[model samples]
Target: MADMQIDSSPVRTVNVTRYVTPLREGGSLPAIAEADDGFLYVLKFRGAGQGVKALIADLLGGELARALGLKVPEIVFANLDTAFGRTEPDEEIQDLLKASVGQNLALHYLSGSITYDPAVTVIEPKLASQIVWLDCLLTNVDRTARNTNMLVWNKELWLIDHGASLYFHHSWDNWAEQSLRPFVQVKDHVLLPQAAELDEVDAAYRAMLTEEKVRSIVELIPDEWLTASASDAIAADRREVYARFLTARIASSEIFVKEAQHARKSLI
Candidate 1:
């Protein structure tokens, strides 16, 4: 198996100690785990169905968000020893994975403490606008208003779950016109409380991201997740779109604050 070499600067400060508990399962990878150092981390392995590509997407996406200064959990790739091998679905580990679907990845076992109601998410309009900006720049279509995959901890909204994104890479270029569509119009359809602060957020994003870092992050994706030709095409398209989006965002220093303001007034 190829080892994922994360840039030492950004993630070196975080330490992943021991595996504490199993979090969730039933996806391409195994459940997340709690590290003995009192931090939450996910444990993944090379499996029969999914390959390194899935892991690559997760890592690269998370890293990109971190670069853009969004609130994201610190993710590190860990080698799960044989002791953490796959167990039966009825096994405790399998049960943990099953229950973790759709929640924030950081709180795997803490699901009981939180509810999944969209109405309860603490996303303000400004924050929602920034998230939409992230989605557009990454060409991520999975962050719909209904299934806003976010976690609110300590009154802050954190983003998660980029597995379903870059969907165009799965087959053909289905997102050609998506960029030209009216993203501002749909702003009223979601919750965003932080709309007035778009300039501040944009400044932070500009200061943190760079082309070299973006390329490095995307290149880290494994070949398995993009095994087939169709899969490769999807990944390629997504990469191109993302590159263009990032370049434009950086040059313009633009923010979609108006959309968020609309969403707030409409009570989305």
Candidate 2:
């Protein structure tokens, strides 16, 4: 994997000291692990179910989330030494660690945070609107009511587990065109009902997501994670494809904004 520039600096690298436990499997093998820095992190593996692209989405989604002025935990590159897997007794986890030895993604753990439950909690409308707009732009498919993928640690919402966003990259078939496809799933988004100021949120988020910013976030993906091969007809440079997809999506923000607004109307 290649190095990526994050926050105007090369991504800081952490070494995994111990693999504590695996989170319940879904799209990828994420685990709670202790790191050399004496912190616990949720490690998303490249060798897992969704593969490196999921890590790419994780990095891109987190970067773009911060760009939109949303809260996300600090993301770091974790260098997994293959030796650590030898200590693991679980066959499945050991295999995952061996395959993911080189470069993986880690998120600073939130100790006492609980999953956001809309029934028991409510986020402000403006914040909800911003989150809705952000998810729609990335075509995030995992933010529906059942999953939510959000945390409330200290009376504030934080975003997490974005590997399921940017679903277009899973297939490179006319990927640029796919970028322009409307996020029809936004209607079912957990936040759409509370996205009170769609127009205002759209305007602000649209202004914030510049082409330069999109490219910057895309560049944050490690080069090895840029897996579109010469064999793939749609992209030789996966980064540019991601950039085009992002710019196209945001450039057509009005369409999805209206999509969310329409969804909101139906919801209320």
Candidate 3:
């Protein structure tokens, strides 16, 4: 595992107002608030017993994708300190505290009943290709053909939800080999025409997202979500897979088009 170079510095502080709203999904809680500087934010509270692992997954996944030169939403860790003096003190909350920014307003109020469909949100085949490529690199099995956890805002796709990855980390050594294997075939597919313009991804982004970064991110996950040794093993395995996928995508000239082709076929 390589050393991760993420700047664990605080970016900004935000005030969150806790007025919970309902989503169509029915389980998650959304809050509306404004940052100190007046920017709107949407804060989605993790469900009971889910802990802060979901938040960690979102933050780490978003950060890694951003480093890989993908167009993800501007996401940062947020702390939910209640007006009544209640504080989230679990490991998950503690990890979020390290990168806490401001609170967020629930997106449902801003976007209004936007269906979580890949075809509708990722309308372009080229963009879809990049998303699929990114997901494969991250080992995010949750973003399947049917349930695309994304938001289409200002004509762009914003990915969300990544707590399900690194599932194999619960137990195993040399997990990198398994993680890096799926990407051996990425070169065979076409990514996007625009990918040609993105010839070089920023080195700082790559350096910040080494295996160490993945481990640190994993450490923030609640122990309840993952037991001791098995969780560590799963995290290692997934990180290795992610690193290999990133290397292949960045270094290769080939594009991944299988998902895009399938998407197109479905449209016809």
lDDT top scorer: 2
Q: After superposition, how far is residue 163 of candidate 3 from its true place, in Å?
A: 3.0
Q: How accurate locally is residue 101 in candidate 1, as Cα lDDT from 0 to 100? A: 27
Q: TM-score-based ranking, best first?
A: 2, 1, 3
Runs in model 3 deviating more than 4 A are 1-11, 24-37, 46-49, 82-113, 116-122, 169-174, 181-268
**CA lDDT for candidate 1:** 0.49
lDDT of 3 at 4: 20
The superposed Cα distance between candidate 2 and the true structure at residue 154, in angstroms, equals: 1.6
Superposing every Cα of model 3 onto the true structure, what RMSD results? 9.3
Instruction: Write one digit per residue (lDDT tens) for candidate 3, span 52-152.
Output: 44454555566666555555545544444544113444454334333333332122223432544533443554454555556545556666445556665
Query: Best candidate, TM-score-wise?
Result: 2
> What TM-score number comes out for model 1?
0.57
lDDT of each: 0.49, 0.84, 0.44
Task: List the pairs of residues colliding in candidate 2.
Answer: none
Q: What's the TM-score of every candidate structure? A: 0.57, 0.92, 0.52
Residue 78 lDDT in candidate 2: 94
Off by over 4 Å in 2: 1-10, 25-27, 228-236
1-268: candidate 1 lDDT, tens digit per residue: 1223333234322233444544343354455455444545555433413344344445656668766667665565443333332453456554433332221222223232232346665556556557765664554545656666566655666666655544444443544544333245434334444455665666766666676766666654433344433443566655555555445545454434344445556753
The per-prediction CA RMSD against the true structure, in angstroms, equals: 7.4, 3.9, 9.3
